[model samples]
Target: MAAIPTSNASLKDALLRPGFTPTSPAATRLSDPIADTPLVLTLDDVLPYDANPRTTQNPKYDEIKESIRQRGLDAPPPVTRRPGEEKYRIRNGGNTRLSILKELYQETGDDRYYRFHCLFRPWDAARGEIIVLTGHLAENDLKGDLKFIERAIAVEKARTLYEAEAGKAVSQRELASRLSADGYPVSQSHISKMLDTIQHLLPAIPGLLYSGLGVDRISKILALRKTASACWDKHYQGEGVEFEMLFQDVLSQFEGDAEEFFFDRFQDELVGQMKKPLALGYEDVLLEITQQQRELRRSMPIVDAPSLPAPPAAAPAPDTSLPDDTAPGDAPPQQPPELPEPPARLAQQTGSQVQLPVTPPAGDQMSDEERQARIDGHVVSPANISPRVVETKRKVAAALGETLPDFNSNALIAIPVQAGSLHPISDLWYIEHDIDTPEHLREHIAQLAFEITQSVNAPGEIIPVDGGIGFSYKQPADEVDITETAHHTLTLLQSLSGATAIALKMLGEQPAPAAMDALGEFQFAAGLGQILLGQPTARDQAPDDSGRLSDGALVKLFRIVRLARRLIDLEIQEYATNTSELNG
Candidate 1:
């Protein structure tokens, strides 16, 4: 062909970023100089050579052949140096183009519209093959180095490629498998680089590699980003930190410190997550995440603000005319006006004679229907009320129909285990509450809590999740001032829920409990509240001898002898009482 005006250019013709042109000669120049276009081949000549012995029998070949049959090949495939020849190589380029063309032709039925490019090498070298293939690797794909992170990724990639080429058995499949196994997914280029590493990257930073400047522009860290990040471009490992932990520590610092966020954020965030795949070193990271999520979702209930005594369930917004009871009636010892106080709180409200629904948790904002359901209590109550409670319950039953609504708040109670088990000191439970409800739910919740725990009970209510009436044994430190949120907490303690009472009882023992002061805010703050929250397990008990208990420790001294005498006398009294009862 005559010296074409556009003699040299990128064969693939992929989209170029700003300041780049597809047909520019720079796009196709070879890195190493050795080339021969497989002895005068064209798109049509690609399939017949069958020279790529490795993939000649590849199943994809049939698909390629079919493509070529339907539409002319679009672009040229890549190539490489022959076994020992300085030229006349057929690594991959031209064939790849033909395959693409074949596929496109079959896909669109118009092969002429298809296009492709070639990485033709110098008649004597494979430099062109190297240069062009390097373009396949975009810089956005690798993890940062322990130090000089960017360079580290590039160097590692280069080393992997070199190793694969040195090993004749290496393949793209192998490279992909290796990366995936390492928790870093391998891709086409990733695999290819591992196999041949034909592509290369020039120093992206001006003096980063030499001047010891920062590896500012990180690239190609896609899958590896989550494992860890380097600061000052240096990755470090603490005494016990894992590959992921190192990155997470720095990431934690960057959360509030991040001015410009990055995609690698997700990896850092999940690393050392507190709950699942639990990592103790990163517990603080998990707590921070919880706080952040709370802020972001607007789900945290505010507890500090002063709120008014929420009026009792409004008496259906007062009917038009006053009832006969309010009007002049045959007076015989006039009764007092009904107050909307909780049967317990009736004395608290003064001068207000409003009719209030006996709806518990009336202070909380709830829909009319929900209030009715809660007051009605039973989702499905007995139709036959035995006439006793007809006057008081018939109206509610009629209004609620078959919808038997239980308390809204979920109760979680922990049943303490026996010694040598998970718990030994006490048979009581730990618990947590999810929804707001009245005190009436206490006994019921406690009973349910007992049944669910398998500690003791007769057919108790089963909670939704596996754990029973969930209590927050994981409370604040003993010194933490929990009184601020006591009100909300107190409302929870209405003596109605055993779960709430037990939770409070445990907290109350501490100086400042988990009690909220009126609103859900902490009335008194402390540095040590949460510390006391975590329960002590049986293992924490002071063992008699690293758990080697001996009778000598308990019964060898004079004090033990006195206790022994007392025990014998007690037994004698118990025997006398039994004997008298038997005689009677």
Candidate 2:
């Protein structure tokens, strides 16, 4: 190596010459010191570092600006002179303050706002990363404004720097300890979750970590990632729906409440939407039914076995002699014939009844299909009802007589039949209707009302349309008034559901009579007028000039009207019976 020329002009000429080269300096000058003490620099002189861990936009920006406006900058921002450049880059803090100052200067044109005080320090790039991170972490910890993503970034920077210096990977606990020493006192678990959020979530959904997501929410999201990943893997062979895809869906579903919506509810909604196939189905329905069964069994106590009729009064001693064939003191020559033992009465099992097929007539010939058809017919009739249901309906019909509506046309009849359970139609109704509480039935009625209104079709057929039906009309008419009447009836039906539910709940607290009275009151309120409307009445009552709805609308309307009327009639009958029984 040769020594370079010391003369300035000679050095400049040599540097400027295209082909001329000079020997490398023994040591590079680390920094240029602009100020020996705290100093003020114009906003133009300060620059942001390329890899500052803190984000440029601060969540506390408005507050910082307001504070600065009220009380002047309390602390100087930390900066370091570039190794050879005139501008100073922030080593750690002051990005927010710098932004606010620029904004204020732009708005107010104040020279004081344009200038900022910063502490300038010397930099050594070789060890500059750790030094910068320590300052950055301290500022963030002090302000408590760094998002999980920012913390993750700082940890990564520290880890990389430490690994480069040490020539190995750093354990999570060791990294956490180092971070704690730098003022970011994070636990290993928390840092692990933050790192997961950064690596797995941030890349897929950028800026989500800045969306007010805290450590707990981040942890839940990470858990969601694991669940979705496993579910997707198991159900779709790691294909089909992606974890990121479902996560984004969940984020969108609960856009405003994502941070508060935990994994359990999210998993429920997700499972409902996706319908992932699994070995077992949802257990809520089964659990509810089991609970209802227990309640029902509790309500109906087991009846004691009936006492056997006393045997015919014993005859006098002369007539009651044990045997006449033998003398006294000698054993009877022959024992009286033992009375024949009565056959054992069979006991009913808990679930399911298996019926044996009836024997065909003697010498009668029938094919297997014919016999099967006969068996099916024997079990269920042409109307698709079991003999048991027919018997139950028959018994109810005999008891209530004309009070009961035609079962074929009256949908309301199903409610009472399902409720009374004298001969239950089947176990299916309880599960099918989801009738654990009165609310379930009321919800069904609301759905039915919507369906019925949507099915209206005939002019002569009265439909429920006003009041609780909530339909809008251009102008009121006679038909509208009739519809309003129907609507009022439907509203009464809904009220009746709530009343019935209340009565059932009261049964657990009050006596049976009180509960029944409550139910009667609800029914009486529902039974205001003749619920069933005749077609002739519907036609004659309508004004000639009243707007006639389309036949399709009238059909839907008729269905609603018929069901509402039947429901009201049923309520009236039920109330009458209940009140009568209480009075008796």
Candidate 3:
């Protein structure tokens, strides 16, 4: 029941009057009048700040506690009491230290721990809680131990407090500006990334984020989620499945350790799950995801690189040439020619073949007898031959009237058939010549069509094409040229259809006249191409009563465009083959 001195002078005088010995060097340096005087307070007199950025115990908690127990608290933590609040709380940081003091008191029954010194700063109601929160943020940041998730949560809370005071929503730029002004300087871009992590990743992988996932990794995860979600939305048709739900399910498997989590593996699993729902091959999905990732990176704000100190001006090259010595013929002790630095190890060798070092397997470590015995245990039998191989051999024998002879066998007996020779001569010829089968040609055409649809832009826009050129539908400007553009467009369409017909002929499938005619139609070809590419044409965007293309017409047009593209590819391929043959 003693009155605590509020003034620095009175507090210092009180300390001296009690014959109090300064605990450490810190206590002796109290010459500054504005510096708050340390007060002797017990555990019951103060409270830990509830909104401290650090949610977990300090990593060096035991070491810190041992230090406090042996040498005593070197830095007295600053405490403050809000207006009308009797309990004093941590003003900035020192939650860990305070907790350690409490633990030490409980374990050792130490009065020294309980009656520790704390610097009390008067809290201002006008300055508000934002100041206090930002103070904790700055302190934790200086320590450089606050987890990314913890920082994100603290910043979000600070944003909430700012909004509450303003009575309106604050943009991320304004929030960043306010935070910097208060003391915690965070960039707007960083704030955006932090908010993204909190909104998208926190709910799914809280344990991972809290387990020290850093800002770079968190940004990557956000980027991946955005890319994968965009690809999913493009192809997903089912009613109930959500991209976020799939993302969470895939992410749960990787929540063990943030350090050990392989992001690429997670991406593979997420994309794999989407494969079925999106009706896309794994490679196709990955390609789309990669494109989306590139777009995201392009859209991200560029941060300026930190300025680096200029290299110390190279010491004037030691005048190494002869040093003005009088020995004329002594070729200035030629320094050994500096060896060129070796090239860095290549991540991947391209164009030229590389000789890779072949490592021996575990069997190489075994004794010769053990290795021989292991090899002898395994035997090849007829059951090992694939059914397709057997069937192929049967067909070959039927056509050849005898089994193919194995020239490698030197034994004087009737030659048996060779397993490798079972492949038909015509099949081998086609494969060796790099000729595509009908099935392969169809697959190639379909893939090309899909790629083109993805690449082309909506009609009337400048669509990028090969060689960095763009194509756009030309609109007639004057009365004289009204039909000129239309005539040229129709002529191009006719040429395309004719070329398709020629390719179909090469495939040994006579082109149906009706099908060719449909492909040549401008409305059918252009309109359906637009629809399939997810770009609505002027006709399709027309009013419902304005005679828009029907669903059936669109479907028919899609088929025509597909057929035309397939035939065109075949014709181009054939022409290339003939040209090469003539050159040979």
Candidate 4:
């Protein structure tokens, strides 16, 4: 409640005032009052805590106690009596100091500090009296109180102390314990609510109240805080005011000219509410709006249809204004010829209902590679009930320029269902291609076959694309040398990369038609090249041989095979290595 004094005076000068002076109890002698040793009080007296939020705990209490024990009590705690109680209570300073005395007493069992007293020193000169009220001391001081933010911080400090000392989740009781520990002069619930207010309510208000309001006031606001007090109550660009707008306006008058500074700082509470549109606990409001909209539609008035014009002008009055047709014969003008019932097998899986679009993703938003990835890696199980998958397939059919027959309800069952979300790289994904030549078509077909089998089948266990059915471990990818073909294709691609003249050398060795498979031919030529380089050294080499894949000619055939089955290109290898290095 105090500010800078109009008149400047040193603290010592102010201490000279009549009621602000120091005094001593005449019960004991001053010179050797302690009888040589200091006294330590016990819990039988008081506990420790911070009296006000403005003041912090004196961490050096132990040292100060030690100093006092070594010398003497320099200052006594200020105390005041509770208004209507015989026991004394501390008003300004906290009981933390008393608790320190108690600790000292329990440790050393000395009561020297309490035993000492002054003998008739001054008539009315007392530094600060230890007036006990309701059994506690009052420690009112001339120094001004703390700011609002300062108090909030102190409240948090007290809360931390309570939690630490109790070693548990703190409650109001813990607040009380902290008050005793930190020398505070407060009630249990008061301290508890003060701490909670800062955390939950203050943050929601933006910078609205940070202009140094009173801690007690802010604490009250936070404790009384409700979701209704924040931004959701804003007029939303004045488009429409919520019912709470008037209440907020009324409250703003109480906050005064906090907005006078930044204006926004004061209105920050409102602005934050607007910028961050929030309505605490979503379910309630959402349901309310839906209910209202339903009610509105129900309240709409019904209207009758206008009379139909006479059909005589166009042709003849349709049936001469007869009632609507009950059968085709009655509406003979509009009737069409009927057809025979559809066959049972033809009714299995096709329908108009299949046209719904599900998994709505923008076609243009995703890149071609991403879209293709979905087609390539995704899975569609028969069990899946993809509400709009039929529509997706129809679109795909259009894209491929394929004919689509009139759908029959039974035909819908034939389509695959949603097994899970599309990963876009699964083995069963649909195939897409721009077919040009027979060679190209053949290559795509071979690649797809190899990819599907490789993806689903391992050397041992295999999961069939069909929910069941696959080859055993001993079987070779449908009785063909799939591994050898794959390796051959890899090597052929490698040979193509080198000089064109070197490629001609391969042609001279074997004709395209003669090669069982171009891919296999490429692998053979590449393996032969490796043996000549001695790149894959055989375990034991013969110095000479006829060279029909003999010890001398073969030259570590397994190693050559691995090299020929190359998956990564030179450029790709470099890129991968660089990326790995960066990640590491």
Tell me the TM-score of each prediction against the true structure.
0.22, 0.40, 0.47, 0.21
Stronger candidate by lDDT (1 vs 2): 2
Off by over 4 Å in 4: 1-143, 177-189, 200-211, 216-225, 229-584
| Poorly placed runs, candidate 3 (over 4 Å) | 1-37, 298-584
- For each candidate, C-alpha RMSD in Å? 25.6, 27.7, 24.6, 32.8
Shift in Å, residue 573, candidate 1? 88
The best-first sequence of candidates by TM-score reads 3, 2, 1, 4
Cα lDDT tens digits, model 4, 1-584, are 88966555676677776684458655542242222233333344332322444343344556766877677655655333333333333344544455556667677777663343222111112211211211122132212233444445555655564455456777766555545554545555455455655655444442445554544345334322333343344323444545355435533544433344332243334433433234333433333332333343333322212222333354434443222112122443333245222111111112211122111122343333233223322123222335486566557667855433322221221112122221111111122222222333233333333333343232322222211111111233454434433333333323322323455667668977754464454557655454344344456854431112322112222222222222122235667889999999
lDDT of 3 by residue, 1-584 (tens): 99774999877887878566877666433222234657777899889998889987677778888889889999898888776566778988888889998998999998988898889776666665888899999988877478888988999999999999899999998998999999998877678878998888887788888888887677668878888888888888888998888888888788866888887898888889999998889978987787666555434322222222332354222332222211223444443355322111111111211111111122333333233223222211112456686567657644743332221211011111111111212110011112223344333333332232223221222222221111222333443422322333333333333544554455555456755664455654554343334344476584222222322223323333533444455567777989999999
Tell how far residue 252 is off in model 2, in angstroms. Answer: 7.0
What is the RMSD, in Å, between candidate 3 and the native fold over all Cα? Answer: 24.6
* Candidate with the greatest TM-score versus the true structure: 3
| TM value for model 2 | 0.40
Report the C-alpha lDDT of model 2 over 274-319, residue by residue, as the tens digit.
Answer: 4443333444322233233334323322222233333334422432
Ranked candidates (lDDT, high to low): 3, 2, 4, 1
Query: How does model 1 score by TM-score?
Result: 0.22
Cα deviation in Å at residue 290, candidate 1? 7.0
Per-residue alpha-carbon lDDT of model 1 for 195-306, expressed as tens digits? 2211221222223222222222222222233222222123232345453444444334433212343534644454443222333346344334433332332321222212
